[model samples]
Target chain A: MDSTPAQVPEGEDLERRAAELHDAMLVVDGLQYSHWNRGVLEELRAGGLAAVHVTIAYHELARETLSRIGEWNRRYQVHADLIRPVREISDIRRARDEGRVGIFYGFQNCSPIEDDIDLVEIFRQLGVFVMQLTYNNQSLLGTGCYEEVDSGITRFGRQVIAEMNRVGMLVDMSHSAERSTLEAIELSRRPIVISHANPASFHPARRNKSDAVLRALAESGGLLGFSAYPFHLRGGSDCTLADYCDMIARTADLMGIEHIGIGTDLCQQQPAEVLTWMRNGRWARELDYGEGSAEQPDWPTQPDWFRNAADFPQLTRGLLAHGFSEDDIARIMGGNWYRILEDGTQPRSA
Target chain B: MDSTPAQVPEGEDLERRAAELHDAMLVVDGLQYSHWNRGVLEELRAGGLAAVHVTIAYHELARETLSRIGEWNRRYQVHADLIRPVREISDIRRARDEGRVGIFYGFQNCSPIEDDIDLVEIFRQLGVFVMQLTYNNQSLLGTGCYEEVDSGITRFGRQVIAEMNRVGMLVDMSHSAERSTLEAIELSRRPIVISHANPASFHPARRNKSDAVLRALAESGGLLGFSAYPFHLRGGSDCTLADYCDMIARTADLMGIEHIGIGTDLCQQQPAEVLTWMRNGRWARELDYGEGSAEQPDWPTQPDWFRNAADFPQLTRGLLAHGFSEDDIARIMGGNWYRILEDGTQPRSA
Candidate 1:
């Protein structure tokens, strides 16, 4: 598919303002499930992203998830000039100052902890900062977004939330069922996040948050990162940059500006098999397509305006054109997430 | 301290009757933390115990706990003639028929699960049937008996209870604080159990259940397995078999016959170092003599009449002499526990 032209105001002065603002701000992508390499790291650096929450586990078990972290550790060592590991909010600033992307770790599912509650601290110490209670099916913690019966959080799920809160891990419920998501917002002592999901009123995808969830999230000081994943967008692959920013504006109106940011859900440079792995893991023997159907058992094509990390500035320019103030644009781009990361990643006092 | 004599009727005919009843009944000890060997198994067999719930994890993490389960698996294979792993209630019957002790696994704390909720099922599949929400300090699940302020069962604790209920694992709150224990009993969909604890009204130990907890336990269809641990007994090492039986009778009066059984909490033949391991694990750097002070930083002396598994028949004699009916004696001997085991260990139907 042909890449869409950047949909900004047709003037060099406006472009310079957007470019300068994107360059000066601490751009933090709330989530991305990309196949990371030097190319992806270079694109993130090129996009002026100071930090990005990278999905390290979908349905991987503890051992496998640890191996993925080990892989990222090696990447940080090898690509020291392009990327750094994010253990705290200071690391994001350090990455920005050093002209490198801070790669923060997250799990799209609770699979990595597998049933052990102590691994929360273990993973937190290893630089995993965010974990979703469920992915797209029923986990020990709670029901996923796709499950017909939503039993909310299980007894074990409640324990996990408290432990995560105590150990400074941000509880993400992006792919959890509605009841589970709402329950998590109510149950977590610390602020939670939907790291990468749109509003259901805008897109109506199963992965999107409801109006009630968004409001509760704001009340609990949680953040909701609007998704750019085509499946979660209002117009799928054809979603215009203008319409995407308008959706963000609408979400900001509902959730307040501080609770909104960009997660993008970018899955760049991944093979179709990786989707199968993400959707099925070791839990299912047969293929489970998750958000895709049997005939479309692969990742949907990303919208052209935000196809890769390098296209991030397009969002900044689009937001500017869509009439968001520079301050609001900066916060929506990363400032809000930066504040949340600062608050969410500290050990709770006894 | 000299061992106390068995406080049962002296007549040889009465002794024979107690022995026959002990041998004939399905004698299930709700909890035991013995240093397992062929000798221990022999003692259990000599006592005519058909099954025993064994503590597998105190404060061990997931990897260490899994190693413990592996150790048990090897033991089950090597000592196949003496012991069998109990995954289901039918296994208890099978062990009895085969003249072997059914070893059911339990955790004295939720450490094996650590932070992940998924491990509840994984551990259940590996033969863990009972799990205490806390040991003697605050865990992710709840406040332990040693913690001053009980915050009740945590949000995570509630989730864990539901997962445990769904997967057929019994929620044991024996070492949890009062509020946490009560909350767990109330929160659990399936009846919870105090797998090894005594009534606080009888002993007044920090580890014993309050009268309110006991009443609630009975009302909620839960079971209380009386602990014979010195710290939980009314008079410590000086607690007479008669006093113990009287305590049991009192508890039965409060909780009804169906809710009373014997856990024993027998730590037979374990070295003082083993107690250190149980009390501290990797959590404490300094010596933590749990239930013991600096002056008594060791395993307390066991009451003579209940020193080891082979002494179990003395309890049957004691209860019989204490004026319990043959039917009540039979129920207290193991029948009550057997019924709870049947009810507590099975996947909950949705």
Candidate 2:
């Protein structure tokens, strides 16, 4: 699908207003972890994002997640106009209020929580608002998506679910197993989220959830985040913003309105090692998948899903071209996730 | 009340053997959270202790805890027979085997566990075996002795209690409040301990447990360590080792040999700020006691009941003088606590 339309009468004015409004709006990325540095953040600011989740949980990523947080703080000082670390939903709003791209730090694995459930609140206080129960293999909490046989959530996992609810942290099951995902959905007191996943309409792999899970999530007031990973696209190489729109459109068609939003899974500055890390269970523990070549990066190359943050407008523009009302487009861009964050992460005491 | 012998049978061989056995037994202090440094550790070794619980949890003591751990490693290079950080029961055995002073790091509060229950396992792995739920004020887990109204263990605290059980951490409630202590005892699947506490036999302060709490702790298959801090000693300044012996004898009488032991809350080698910090909650907050002066190091001077580690044997001599049997003295000195550590802190997987 040609996502880019040729010679529109309102093109210049629409593009200018889109840039201006995007700059002004409180844009939050549901999930995206990249090997972010000054340049990558500048790209995000250029894309009109108010906040992005800086992920550091996979084993292949740098060992110290804390130091990564410190690194971001230090780097942002040199580029204060472009970026800042966001600890709360209000921080995101303040970033938008100040025209700075806010960063919400998160880990894709519950590993950083280690074994104690209480550390969840400490990390939350320290600005971590999102955590996946497992990273592609079994943890003390639950099984990951890549495990050969998923055992679902453990007894401790249920306790973690309850504690997370009490502490007001958003539970992301993007890389979790189907059994665990279903268990989490039932077990969580608050709405449980698949922070990034594709519908089987777009990809039938285990990495993608069925339309049923998406609908179930919506029923429970959770949001399904559409991943930007190329494998999730229906037409392998022939993919673009329009194809992504089609996937979102199909999800909207199947699950109805308010059930979907963009996860981007964008790796504008992510290194190849992060993909390799995700493929293995721990740093190097391979699941039953056949031995991969050491030379190859863990994940395949990005297929033409909008190149970087700079191409975010193309996504908004592409959705508009698909006959989606502007209100629906706004929800898809970020409003849906904003609602989930506000509702799901608000502390019970608060 | 004179702890020194009322009658000295001149030059008895049994008295000489008693002195020799006391000196030779590789006596371990089990616990002492003095603001430690090289000087303090050297004094511990000089005092002939095989090991001591180097506390890292009390707000004032830990600044040098990590450094002390490093120094112990360095001292192992020079005086390997004198010091080693103990992480497991096996380490205690190894320290005995190697004739090295085994340092089991302890926390006077779960503040280091911060809010994450996952940190329980992480710190357990790091050699922190004993953890107090609250110091003397409010923490995420529960209220301390100083909190005016004590709320029992929160739901998050329940999960933490379970995780601590699962991870083999000894839950200490020495400075914890009444309700929180009772709740912790009820919630922990494994035997929970008040690593150091006195009964109202000594002081009528919240710092000492009532007979009911002590009896319940003992009946639940847990031990209550009798603390020797003079503020809790009966008759205050007029008290002697015989008085201390009488208190331990009575506690032993009440709790049985298996459920009673001694934990000298020795503050030797700790500078004044350590006490001030303890009294004031680590310099971050002022004294919880309303009238305490903030600027001055307002903690009362170390009582004359005990001065240093060398004073341990006088208690044994005093206990024998008080007509307690040798077996009872052994249990009181360290054997009962040794059994408790073996029973309570072993990993479930083990």
**lDDT by residue (tens digit), candidate 2, B1-350:** 55655453332543564566555554556567774556666666655565676676665232233333444444544555467767566676667567566887788876665555556665575567788888887878889887889998987788888877976888888888888888888888888877777788666756788887888888888887777766666665456776777777787777777787777777766666666666666545534442234553344444453566666666666666677777776676666767777787776731
Query: Tens-digit lDDT track for model 2 on A144-218?
Result: 887888898999999988878977888888888888888888888898778877887677767788766777777
Estimate, for each residue in B73-113, the C-alpha lDDT of model 1 and write its tens digit.
Answer: 65776788899988678999999999999999999999888
TM-score of 2: 0.53
Alpha-carbon TM-score of each model against the true structure:
0.53, 0.53
What lDDT is reached at residue A39 by model 1? 93
Per-residue lDDT of A242-318 in model 1, one digit per residue for the tens? 88888888888888999999998898899998988888877788877888898887789887788798999989888
For model 1, the superposed segments whose C-alpha errors exceed 4 Å read A1-350, B1-10
Per-prediction DockQ, in order? Answer: 0.02, 0.02
